[model samples]
Target chain A: MAGVRAAVVGTGLIGGSLLLRLRDAGLDVTGWDPDPVARGHVRRWGVACPDAVEAAVTGRDAVFLCGPLPTLSGMLARVAAATPEHCVLTDVGSTKAEVAATATASGLGHRFVPGHPMAGADRAGPAAADPGLLVGAAWVLCPGPNGLASFRRLAALLIEVFEARVVPMSAPEHDAAAALSSHVPHLLAGALAGAVQRSTLRDAVLSLAAGSFTDGTRVAGGPPQRTANMLLGNRDRVLSGLASVRAMLDELADALRAADAGTLTDRLAEGRAARATLGERRFDTHQREFPAPADHAGELDYLRALGAAGGHLTGCRTAGGAVTYTGQLPHTPDPA
Target chain B: MAGVRAAVVGTGLIGGSLLLRLRDAGLDVTGWDPDPVARGHVRRWGVACPDAVEAAVTGRDAVFLCGPLPTLSGMLARVAAATPEHCVLTDVGSTKAEVAATATASGLGHRFVPGHPMAGADRAGPAAADPGLLVGAAWVLCPGPNGLASFRRLAALLIEVFEARVVPMSAPEHDAAAALSSHVPHLLAGALAGAVQRSTLRDAVLSLAAGSFTDGTRVAGGPPQRTANMLLGNRDRVLSGLASVRAMLDELADALRAADAGTLTDRLAEGRAARATLGERRFDTHQREFPAPADHAGELDYLRALGAAGGHLTGCRTAGGAVTYTGQLPHTPDPA
Candidate 1:
C-alpha cells in the first residue's frame, strides 16, 4: 500500500491500534479525540494529535472513525463540514446498517464509507494498542451508493496496513451477520451471567464455569451505549437474527420438555459441532499471550469482592478468557 | 486438611491432574487406568500406578473414578470387589443423578459418593493434565451415606491442595446444574457451529471470529463418547436445560419477527447483564487461554472436504460444548 495519511477518531482501542499499525508501516497518520483522556492515550502511542476532528480530517486522505456508535455521527458531521472533498471516511463500529442509515439521513453520505474493522480486545484504550490488532483479522467494509470506487480502494489500502481481510457486504447483511456472530451471543451471555446472584452460588458457579460462559458473554462487558446502539441501530436485522436463534432454541426446549432423547442428543450434538467448527482454527501464540504482570492476589481479591456484591462471580487464577480485568464488566447473559 | 491416601481411577485429565495435585501436597496417591495409553499418561504425572481398579481402591481409603458413564458400573463393580469396608468411591463425571443411580444399582451405594468437579478443561486425557488444573476451581460432592465422611475428608484435602471451592448439591441437583452449566451449552454451540461450513470463507470467518466464537464452542471439542455419555446420562436434565435455552431463543426470535425494538432491547439488555457477570468472573480461565489451536483449522478443512464429498455437513469438529482440532489431519477440500 502506498503511503496513506489517515485521521483516527476515538483514539481508543481500535483507533489507537490502527494508528500504531499505520505508523509501524511508515504511514503518516494523525489522531483526533474529544476526550482529554483519549487524546492523551493516542499521544502516548506516538501518533500526531490534532485538536479537532474537522482539523484532523480536512488534510488527511482518509478519516477513520473508531469510537462507540453514538460518537460516530457527531464526528462524521464534523468531518463532513471540513474534510477535503477527496477524503474518504470509514468506521470500526460493531454495527453498520444503522450507522450507514444515520450517515445517509444526516446527508454526509457521499464522503462516508460504512465500514467496520472486526478486531479488538476486551480492555479498551490506547494503552492496549497493538499494531497487529487487525493482523489477519476481518475488516468488514459496507459501502453506500455514493461511497465510490475510490473509497473501495481506500478500504483495500486499510486492509493492507492493518494486515486484515476485507469482506464486502451491504449494511443490512453486515448488521445481521454481526448480530449472528456477535450481538445475540453477547446478549445470551449477559443474561446468563446476570441471572446468577448470591442465591445462585455464583462464586461456585464461576469456578466451575468454562470457556463456554466467557465466549457466550464476551460482548456483555462492552460499553452499554455502544451495544445498545448496535441493537437499536440495526433493529431489523438484529431482530431477524434473534428470531432465527429463537426458532432454534424453541425447538430445543420442546424436545427437552417432551423428553425426546434423540432430539436432545441431536441438539447437544449440533451445538458441539457449531462450537467445534468455529474453534477449528486456533491461533498459535507464536508470541506469549498474557503480558499480565505476575498474579496480584490482592487485586484478584478486590475484583472478587466487587463481583460478589453484584451477585456476580469472578476468577483471577486461571487464564482462559477475559485476559483483561478492566472494562464495564459483563452484565448480560444469553441463556442459550 | 489431614494427610490422606487417595486412589484416582480412570486417570485422564481430571484424574491425572487430581493425582498430581494430591501428590504435590504430600498425600499418598495411586492411579488405576485400564487403558494403556491413559495409564502411561497418568504414570507420567507422578501418580502411583496400581495394577487395576480393584487393586487401587482395595486398601486405599478414598478412590475417585473419573471417566465416562459406561465405565462407571464396571468401575463400581471393581470397587465393590476390593474396597476396604470404609472406602469411599467418588466420581468426576459431568452428570451426577444417573451416576448415583448406577452406584445404587451396582450395590455400592453407601460406600459410593457421586461427584462432579466443576473445574476442568474442554481438552481431556492425561496429555491435557496439569497439577494446578483444579486450583481455585470448584468441586461438587454429592455424598450418599455415613461412610462418606472419610471421602469428605479426602475431598477437603483435595480442596486445600487444588485451592478450589466446593458446592453441595444432591446428585439430581448436580445433574440439573451440569445440564445448565455444561451440557445444553455444548449442544447449542454444536448446532450453531454446524450451520457454518469451515471452507466457507475460512480465512475471513476465522480471522474475524474473535474470542466469542471460539469460547462459545470450546465445549463442543470434547471426546465424542464422553460427550455422548453426558447427554445420555443426564438426558432428562439436559433435555430440560435445552428446553429453557430453546424458550429463550424463541423469545429472541419473536422480538425479531415483530421488529419490536423495545422488547428486543429489553431482552438484549437482560442478556448483556448476564454475560457481564460471567465475563467479570473471567469464567474458566485464570491463566492462559490459547486461541483455538491450528488443529481446528484442519478439522474445518476436513469437514469442509467431507461435506463436499458427501454433500452434507460433518460434526467431527465438535464435541462436549467446545470445538477440537487437535487429533486428526484434515483432507483437502476437493474430492474426486
Candidate 2:
C-alpha cells in the first residue's frame, strides 16, 4: 500500500510508532502535530511531515487518532471537519465506551473504527516511540458489522507492517477485557507500592526491589493520565476487576492462614506452571534456567542411599570445597 | 580473623555467593553441599568445595547455613557434632522465625546466629547463584543477645565483600517484615494469575497476555517448592500479610465502585511518586539508558500541537498538510 495515504494524530509513542512503521513500509505517511518539537521529531524519525491538516487528511485513505483519552474527542472533531466522507477514522485508545459514545453523539459513526494496541511502554513522549515497537504485539479491533470490512483492511495493513495480530471483538467485551488485563493491574501495582512505601523498611526494601518488584510496579509508574482515564472511563469494568483481585487475595489469605503445606505447595506448583505459560510471551522470551549439573543427580542419589544404609553422613562438600547443597546430620530434626 | 576457617553449609545462591566473597577476602573458606552437580557448579562459580562436613566444620571459626527451611535444623545438628566450640553459625533464608526456633531447639543456639539474606532470585540451584548477588543487599542478622558480637562480626565481613547493610532485629520482627514485604506480594501475584485463568476470557485474554500481564503476574510463577516452604513456613506472618494486602485492595475497590476518580488519581499519583523512588537504589551502576538523537525532543513537541488542531488529516500523499490534535470531530468508535 505504498500509495496508501495515512495521517496520524497525537504523535506519541503508540501513534508515533505506528506512523514510523507505516513510513518504513514505504506507505505515503504524513504526520500532523501542532507541537513543533513533536513535528520535528516525527520528521527526524523519518515520517513525511505535513505543514497543514488538509495536506495530510483530505485525500488519505486512513487516519489514526492516538492520544490521551481526554484529547481524543476534540481531535476527532477536527478530523471530521477536513476529511471526506470516505476517509476511515480509527483510534488507538485503551477505552472504547466513551470514545464510541462521543463519536455517535457527534454523528461520525459511519466512518470510524475503534482499535487498541495492547502494547505500550512505561515511557511516553515521541522519544520513547519506536518504528517496530508494536511488531508481534496484539491489537484488538472493535468494529460493528457494517464497519468490519474497512476495519479489517486497516488491521491487515497493521499486521503487515507491525507484525501485530488482530483480534476482533465487541466494544464492551474489549473494554471489560482491558479493564481486567491492564487498568486494574496498574492500579493494584501502584497501591501495593504505596502501601510498602509506608513501611519503616521502605527505604531498605525498596532499594533491594528486584526484577519482580520492578516489573510488578512498572506500569504503576508509567504515564499517569493514561491509566487514570482507563480506570475512570472504564469505571464499571475496572471496579469489577478490582473485586476479582480482592477475591483472589481473600483466597490466598485463607490458604496461607490455614498453614497447610500441601495447599501452599499445590498453589505454588500451579503458579509455576502458569508463569511458564506467561513466559512464552515477548517479555520473558529469553528466560534461561540453569539446572544443577547432571552429575549432581548422581550425587543426590548416592547421598540418599548413604542415608538409607547403616552409614550415616555428617556432611559432604563438593570437590572445590566451596559449594554445598545438603546437611546430613546424625540426629533427626524435631517436629516444629 | 583473617586466619579463621569458615564453613558454608548449603551451596545455594546465597551460600555460594557468601563463600566466594569470604575466601576472596583472605579467609580460609570451605563449602558443604551433598548434591554433586551443585557442588561442581558452585566450585566452578569460585567456591571452595569441601569433601566432608566434619572436615569442613571441625576447625571452622564461622559457618553460614544457606538452604531450604526444612534442612536448617538438621544442618545445625551436624555442626553441633563436629564444629569447634567457638564456631559461630548463621543462616540465609527468607523468613527468620523458623530458623531462630530451629537453631535454639537444636541445642546449637548458643553457638548459632539465626540470620537471613534479604536478597535472592526467582531461579535457584548452584548455577543460578551469582558470587556477587548479595553485594549491596540487605542481610538481616537476627540473634539472641548472647550471640550478638559474633553475628555482628559475621555481618561486618559481609559488608566488605557484599556491601550489604546489616540490619539487626529479633527473629519474629524479621519474619513479620518479610511477610509484609515479600510473601504476601508473591501470594497476590499467584492469585491474580489464578483469577485470570478462571475468568471468562481465560483462554482468549491470557493468549493475548503482553508485557504488563506477564509483569503483573511474575511473582505468582516463582519456584513451587520454595514458595510453598516460604509461605507455610511462617504461616502466621504470611497470613497477617495477606490481611494487610486484602485491606488495601478492598479500599481500592470501594473507591472504584463509588466512581471516586479523585481517590483513584490520588492512589495512582502516590504510587507513581513512590515507584520513582526506586531509581534511588542505584543497583544498575553498570548500565545506562541508550542515547537517542538530541533533536528528536523539539520535533515531537511540534507534532502534539498539530494533532490538537481541529482539522481533517489523512496521509503522506497530502504532504504539506498537517493533522493537529484538536477537539472538533467525532470519531465513531465501535460500541461494545
Candidate 3:
C-alpha cells in the first residue's frame, strides 16, 4: 500500500473524486484532465498534475480510466501502452461487457478489471470531486480472465481506502443486474418526466407536484449525453429491462381497466412489502404523547394543534375517560 | 368562521385530520365512524362523538363525507338526509367526477362541493390522523351549482385554517389532472416495486437500490386498499394516463432497441429540463473561495478534504503555477 502509485485519466466527478480518494489514503496519485481548469484544480489538491496522460501513467502501479464510456476503449489502450507491464488497468465505466470485449481483443484482458461504482451527485466535473463521494456506495467488480489477482487488489483498495461496498459479479451479470437496478429506472424516470414536459398543462401539473413527483423524477435530471451513453452501452440489457417494465405496466393497466380490485390490491400490497426492504434504514423519528380529548371534535383539535406544532399522530389509545396519542414530530426544526 | 357547526363521517387519516382541522379553527364539529376504535378516538379528542351518523349531521352548517370512494355516495345520501336545509356538503374523495355525478343524481348537487386534498402520510387510520398534513398542499375544489358559495366558504377555511392552497377546477378537469399527477404516478410506483418483488434476485436488487429506486417506489408503499380505491375511482382518467405512460415507455424502448443515441439524448435532456421546473423553489446554496494549488493531485486532495469537511468547489482558476478554487460550503453542521 505504501508504494502504490495510481493515475486517473479524465477528471470529471468520478475521476476527480477517485484521484483525491487515492491521495488521501496516502497513495502517490497523479491525475490528468483535458480541461485546463479541471487539471489546474487537481494540481491545487497537492497531487501531481502531469502535462500529458502518458507521463501520468508511465510508472503507475494502477491506472484508472474514468473517461466517458464512448472513449473508454481508446483511453484504456493508450494508458495500457504507456504503463509498465505489471501495472494493473481498471475503469469506472457504467457498462462492462463492451469494455471486457475490447480489452480481450486488444490482448490487454489479463491486466484489465472492469468496475462500476453505484454512486454520483447532481453536479459534475473535477471541481465536484469529493473523496467521500464513494463512501458506503456499492462498487461492482467484474474482473476479466487472468485479472482475478488484480481485481482482488483493487477491490481491497476500494474497500479500505474509499470505504466502498464491494459487490462481485461477471461482466454480463453486472450488466443485467444494473439494467434492472439502475438503467431502466433512470429511463422510466426520464420517460415519465419527458411525458410531463410535453403536456399542455405542464405548469399546472408541476404546481400540484409533491414529494412523490420530485422523488420519482430526480434521476431524470442527469446529464443527457452521459445518461444516453450508459443506456446505449448496455443496450441489450436495457432493452430487456424495458420489456420487463412494459410487461409490469401492462398488467397494472389490465387490472385497472378491468377494475379488478383483488389483483390491484395484491400488486399494490406486494409493492409495498418490497419497497419496505430497499433502504433497510431510516432516520430516527421524534415521538410525543398527548392526553385524550372529550369527543371527536376535541380529538381533531388535539391532532390539529399537534400538526400545527409540526407533529403527526403515530398511534393513540383510550383508557377510562382519557386517551393517549403518540405521534412523530417534524424532522426539520420549527421556523424561528 | 366562528359558530360554524360541522360534521365528519369516516375517521380514517383524511377524515380524522379534517375534523381536527375544522375544530381547531374554532368550529363545533361532531363526528361518527362505524369502527368503534375510530369513534373512540373522536370521543377522546373532546369533540362530540355521535353514535348515529344522522345525529352527527342533524344540525351542522357543513357535512364532510370522508369515507371510502365506494361508500361515499351512501354517506353523502345519509348526511344529506339528516342535514339542515341550508347545510353545505363537501367531500375529500380523490376523484371528483364520480362523486359529483352521484350528488347530482341524489338531487343534492347544489349542496355538494367536491374537493380533493393532495396530501397524505405513509400510515392510515384515526391513529395516524395529522392536522398539518394538508398545510401547504394543493386542495382541488370542484364546486357544484349552489355549492359555489359553500366552496368559497370551505376554500377560505382551507386557506386560513389549514394553510392549504385552494385550486378550483371542473370535476372532469380535476379527475384528468389528478390522474396524471397522483393516481398514475402511484400506479407506476406500485408496478415498478411489484416487478422487483417478483424478481428472483429481489434481495440483491433491493440491496443495490439507490435514491432513484427508493424515490420512484415511495408511493408504492402506501396502504394497498387506499391506493386501489383511488385508482378505481379515477378509472377512465387513470387508464388514459396509463396509456400515455405506456406510449412513452414504448418510445424509450424502441430507441433503446434501435440504439438511437440522438433520440435517447433528446428525451433525456427533455426530461431533465422538465424536472428542473417541478420544484420552483430551492435553497440558496452558499459558496466559498479558497486559494489555488501547485499541482493537479494537490487540488484534488484539497477538494476532497473540503467536501469531507462539508464544502463544494464552485469555480477554480490558475495563475503562475498556483490555483484558487471557489466552492459551496456544506449546508449542515459537521458531525463531531
Candidate 4:
C-alpha cells in the first residue's frame, strides 16, 4: 500500500478529503483541480498539485475522478485514456448508471468501478475538507461486467486507507436505493418547505414551527442548483420514487378521511418499526473468503448478495490466490 | 402573582412541567394525576399532590387541564364543574378545534381558553419533565367570542413565569397551521420510513442512510399511537395538507421526466427560500394598547391580527381600564 500510486482529479471537499486521507495512509497520491485556488490549497497542505489532469494520472496505479455529476463522464473519459492499462478507475459521484454506461461505451468497463461515498458536510471546497469525513462511512461500489478485479482493488484500498465499509452492488441497484433513501427525501423536504411558503398562514406557520418542521426541511437549505443536478441526474429512479411516495400519501389521506384507524395505525407502526432498525444498527462482524482470479464471477456474485442483504466489506485482502473478505451481517429487527 | 392559585390536572410531561414552573413563580399550585406513581413524583418535587381532580381545582384562580387528546374533554368537564365561577380554565392539547367546541357546548366558553404549548421531548411522564422545556417556547392561545380577557390573563402569567411567547389565534387557525407544521410532517416522515421498509433494497438503503434521511424521518420514531391520534384528531386539515404536498410531488415528477430545468430549479429555489426564513427569525419588540372591557371585540380582532402576522405577546397587563401588550413583529427577509 505504501508504494501504490493514486491520483485524485477535482480537489473540492470530497476529493481534497480523499487526497488527505490517501496521503495520511502512506499512498503516493497526486491531486489535480482545474481551479487554481483549489490547486493552491493542495500545495499548501504539502500534497503534490499537478497542473494538468494527465500529469496527475500518468504512471499511477489508480485514478479517482472526484468531480460533480456534470463533469464526471468527461473526467472519466480523460482520466481513463491518460492512466496506464493496469490502473483501476473510480469516481465519487452521487449517481452511477449514466457514468457506468459511458465507461462501457469507451471500452474502459474492465478498469472502471463506479462508486459513491456516503459522507459530506454543509460547507464545500478544500479549505473546509476534513480527512475524518470518510471514517466508518458506507462507500457503495457498483461493479459491472469484467470490472470485478478493479472493484476488488479499489474496495481493498478504501477499506484499508479510510476504514470505510465497502458495499458492492450493480449500477441500477445503487441508483434505485439512493433514489428511495436520498433523492426522494430531498424532494419531500423541498415540497414541504414550498407548501409552507405558499400558505396564507406563512408567518404564523413559521412562528409556531417546532422540531418536526425544522428536521423535515433541513435538507432543503442546500443550494438549489446542486440539489437540482443530483435530482435531475438520476431522473428515472427519482420519478419512480416520487410515484411510490405519492401513492403512500394518497393511501394515508384516504385512511384519515375514512377514519380507518386500523390502516392508519398499521402504516405508522410499519414506519416506526423501520425507524427503530436505524438506531439498532450494530457492527456485528461476519467474514467470508472466495478463491479470487480462478472464481472471479463467483466472487462478484457473493459480494453483490452480501450488499443486497445489507452487509458491508470491512476488509479485503488477496493472499495465496484467495480473497478473504470481512463484513458484517445485517441486523434484522422483529416484525412490527 | 405570589398569591395566585393554579392547579394542574392529569399530570404528565406538559402538566408536570407547568406545575413546577407555577410553583417556581411563587404560585400556590396543586397537581392531580390518576396514577399514584406520578403523584409520588409530584410529592418528591415538593409540590402539592391532591388526591382528586375536584380537590386540585377547588378554589383555584386558574386551572390547566393537561391530558391526552381522548381524555381532555372529560377532564375539562370535571375541572370546570369543581372550580369556582371566577376561575379561568385552559387545556394543553395539540388540536384545538374539537376541544374548543366541547367547551362551547358545555357553556364554559367565556372561562375556557384552549391552548397548545409548542414544546416537548421524545420522553414522556413526570419523571422526564423539565421546567426549562417551557422556556422560550411558543404557547398558542385561541380566544373564542367571549374569551379575550381569559386569554390575556393566561398569556401574561405564562410570559412572566416561564418566559413563553404567547401567540393568539382562533381554534381553526391554530389547527390549520399545526396541520402543515406538525401533523403532516409526521405523516411524511412515516411515509418515507414506510417506503424504505418496503423496498427490496431495504438493507442497502438503510446502510446508506445519511443526515437527510435521518432528519427527515426523526419524527416517525415517536409513538405510533400518539402520532395517529394527532393526525386523526385534525383529520380535515391533515387531509388538505397531504393533498397539497402530493400535488407538489406530481409537479416535481413531471419536471424531472420532461427535463424541465427551469421549473425544477424554480421549485427547489422556492423551497430553499422558505427554509431560509426558519433560521432568520429574531424577536424585535413592538408595543400596543387597547381599552379593554370597553371594546373587547376590537381587542380580540387586534390580537388575532397580530397572531396571523406572526407576532407574539411578550408581556400583558391591565391598568387604568387599558390593556398594554408587548409583542414582537415578524421578521421578513428580502424576497428570494
Scoring only the A-chain of each prediction against the true A-chain gives TM-scores of: 0.76, 0.77, 0.81, 0.92
Q: Identify the runs in model 4 with alpha carbons over 4 angstroms from their true place.
A: A1-6, A16-30, A36-51, A59-61, A121-130, A292-294, A319-321, A332-336, B1-5, B16-29, B35-48, B122-130, B291-295, B317-323, B333-336
Better of 1 and 2 by TM-score: 2
Q: After superposition, how far is residue A331 of candidate 4 from its true place, in Å?
A: 3.3
**TM-score of candidate 1 against the unseen true structure:** 0.71
Give the per-residue lDDT of model 2 (tens digit) for B159-192: 6556665555567766766776677667767777
Worst 10 residues of 4 chain A by lDDT: A291-300
**Per-residue accuracy of model 2 over A214-294 as CA lDDT, tens digit each:** 777788778666677777778888877767766766666676777766766676666566566555533211111112232
> What TM-score does each of the candidates earn?
0.71, 0.74, 0.77, 0.90
Task: Give fnat (model 1).
Answer: 0.32
Write down the lDDT of every candidate, Cα atoms only. Answer: 0.60, 0.66, 0.74, 0.86
The sequence of per-residue lDDT tens digits that candidate 1 reaches over residues B1-336 is 345678888778888888888887888888888888887766676666866666677687778888667788776777767877677778888877777777777777767877666666778778788888777665666655433343335445555576544444556656665666677666655544543322232233333456655665566666645665667677776775655655555565566566565675666566555545555432121111112322333333442332122111111132344342221121224576
DockQ of each: 0.14, 0.20, 0.26, 0.71
Off by over 4 Å in 3: A1-5, A19-29, A41-48, A85-88, A126-132, A279-336, B1-8, B17-31, B41-51, B55-63, B85-87, B281-336
What total of clashing residue pairs does each candidate reach? 80, 71, 35, 0
lDDT score of residue A32 within candidate 4? 97
Model 4 C-alpha lDDT per residue in residues A42-150, reported as the tens digit of each score: 9999988879889888999998888778888888888878888999999988899999999999999999999999877655788878888887789999988688778
Task: Give model 2's TM-score versus the native structure.
Answer: 0.74
Predicted model with the maximum DockQ: 4
How far residue B245's Cα lies from its native spot in candidate 3, in Å, is: 2.2
